[model samples]
Target: MKSALIILALSFIATFSNAQKKVLPVTNVTTGKEIYAKHCMTCHQVDGVGAQNMIPPLIKTDYVLGDKKRLIKIILNGLKGDLDVNGDMYSGEMPSQALLKDDEIAAALTYVRKSFGNSASAVTIKDVRRVRAANKTISK
Candidate 1:
């Protein structure tokens, strides 16, 4: 009886050990360009040139390459009223994208800074986190 029990237990262990492990599908990696496309492309356009007399072009603009904090705020808080860009005034209203995660915001901003003929520093996740925290404080 003891030998039979031991054999049963060993077989059970062997059955489990030889069982096939679940193979998980690889997760899709989200890129900065992809994020931008999902969020900003409709307004900014594919070339980042924006709409004439409406959405301001992001190319070679201070708004794109100047201050990282302000740029981040624009995305988080949105912008309205009149906006001047390199002597052109854009009356478009930008909706807030506060729902985006820190990493996503950082990636989108980094993509903008580097694209559309603008060469600027990458906006890190830490930078977005800091600004988002400050925004919360200011709002309250």
Candidate 2:
């Protein structure tokens, strides 16, 4: 009986420890939401409608709906100059969030891609890490 109890206790402890392990808590959607809140919300607004012609809306925009890779690159590297969004030209520089950790960037991008009526595959930390490493090489 004592041996059985000991085994049970060990199993419980193992289970608890496993549960506590930190392994990218945020899903792509959640990560995107977090990123939006932390970074994009100020300009894009909580409802995804930007300030008239200033920021440009994230909801149902061609920029968000089109080209996944381009979107990913934009998030990873930032956008600049003039760009067309739903028939309007948005001319501004989106500063690089290069300082953000790879996972964070991935989470944010994932959230953005999945949120605001945009649906796409989740962005993995690995994907962000790869892009960051590539950019680092180019910048150097």
Candidate 3:
């Protein structure tokens, strides 16, 4: 009976391990990077360092480190205000990214958040959709 119980436990563990591995669907970081290069890298720069006193830098920027909700809004709707990033005042007009799909925004944001020495949770399409929806409702 004890041997049977041990075998059952082992089987359960094996199943759990397999399930964990299967949880993550295939992610194409290359595609995400390509999108960023075409859309974002021009302003944000390849290394995420924006022009000094002009475009705000994404690497170690307070905008990325502060509130996640605010960042989502900025990505979706664009930002136009005076933002102090790393003790430097950055006031610029960032065009709205509403044209991009939610999934594209998620991928770009996720790439930005993960790259350039910044580590954070992955941004999901659902997150982008929720924020965009909330913005629309608030504007109306």
Candidate 4:
């Protein structure tokens, strides 16, 4: 009976520990730089200067360094219409990148915010998850 009790306790402890372990999503793409290169470099350009009067620049722009939630949504849902960036009117449409996993989105955005002469906070995985959940954005 004592042997059985010890086994049961050990089993419970093992189960609890496994449950507590955090599992981050797996992807072939690692690092924010890689994600940015694959997903964002074409539009924003290698230096993030973007096309003149066309795609908006990511250089110290309010949109990039602004509210984290809005930025996350932009990546998830895409954006249309014109934006007045640093007193310049830029017009373009950004297609939805919702297919990116939460970690991917967070990584790319964090990279953008930190790159292109912009110094903003890193977008956390928790932040992405919360925003994704709030907006019902699903990742493919």
Candidate 5:
């Protein structure tokens, strides 16, 4: 009976620790929402549906769910001129968000990738850093 109690206690502790590990992603999501509200929501809108004929929507578009590096580059380098998404065309300029920290960018993107009917992996700060570094090489 004493051994059984110890086993139960261990199991509880292990489960609790594992649950704690899951919270980090939730925290990131929360932070991303806040950042998006401040920096992106105006153009992308609260529902992630962008303005028609101007700003593009974030709703499961290839730009939001496509290559991680390319997505990151858009934030870092900004996009301009004609671009097509889901049969729609947007020629408006997207200003660079390179001013945001790497982690901020990651969280914002991770939130985007997981939101608006999208289901994708989270973007990590490390991924942002690597992409940012690579972009520098291409520019020069």
Candidate 6:
């Protein structure tokens, strides 16, 4: 009976382990570009040059290549108030993209980071999840 119980436990563990494992989608530059074109390109522009005296450019900006957590939060929670980018000031209201799925946000951010003449690591779904969870706690 003990041996049977042990076998059952092992099977449960194996099943749980397999259930916990997830295969994330491969990061596609084309998908990212498409997402950007659909959602971001309007403001940031295809060149990511942004509008002068209004939208801040994403090119090589510290905000883009800086702390991953803050960047993710900005995407999830949106941004307001004064922002200085490369000696210019922008006070535009960046609405929350929290409605976007985690993968979509990651892809868009990854595209932004890797493109616009900026070379940075891709933003993963894990990164987005962590920030979203933390933001929830902070808001509550």
In the range 15-118, model 3's lDDT, one tens digit per residue, is 99999976543234665687789899999999898899999888877667656778889877788889888888988999988898777877888888888888
lDDT of 6 by residue, 22-49 (tens): 4555356777898889888899899899
* Residues 1-140 of candidate 5: C-alpha lDDT, one tens digit per residue: 99999999999999999999865443388899998999999999998999999999999899899898889999999999999988899999999999998888999999999999998888888889999999889896
lDDT score, residue 35, model 6? 86
Q: Please report, in order, the local distance difference test score of every candidate based on alpha carbons.
A: 0.85, 0.75, 0.81, 0.85, 0.91, 0.89
TM-score to native of every candidate shown: 0.78, 0.74, 0.77, 0.77, 0.79, 0.81
Off by over 4 Å in 4: 1-22, 25-30, 137-140
> Taking the tens digit of each residue's C-alpha lDDT, what string does model 4 give over 45-94?
98899889898889988889999999999998999898898889977899
Residue pairs clashing in model 6 are none
Task: Provide the RMSD of all predictions against the true structure, rounded to 1 decimal.
Answer: 8.0, 3.5, 7.7, 5.4, 6.5, 6.0
Which residue ranges in model 1 land beyond 4 Å of their true spot?
Answer: 1-30
Candidate 5: stretches off by over 4 Å: 1-27
Show where candidate 2 strays beyond 4 Å: 1-20, 23-25
Model 1 per-residue lDDT tens digits across residues 48-139:
98999988887889889999999999999999999899999888799999998888888888888888778888888889999999999898
Indicate the residue-level lDDT of 45 in model 1. Answer: 94
Q: Judge candidate 2 at residue 136 and give its lDDT.
A: 71
Residue 60's lDDT within candidate 4 is 88
Write model 2 residue lDDT over 1-140, tens digit each, in one string: 99999999999999888888655345456666777799878888986878776788887776676765566677768889888888888897788777777777777767776776777677777777677677778766
After the best TM-score superposition of candidate 2, give how far the Cα of residue 24 lies from its true spot, in angstroms: 3.0
Better of 1 and 6 by lDDT: 6
lDDT of 6: 0.89
Give the winner by TM-score: 6
Clashing residue pairs in candidate 3 are none
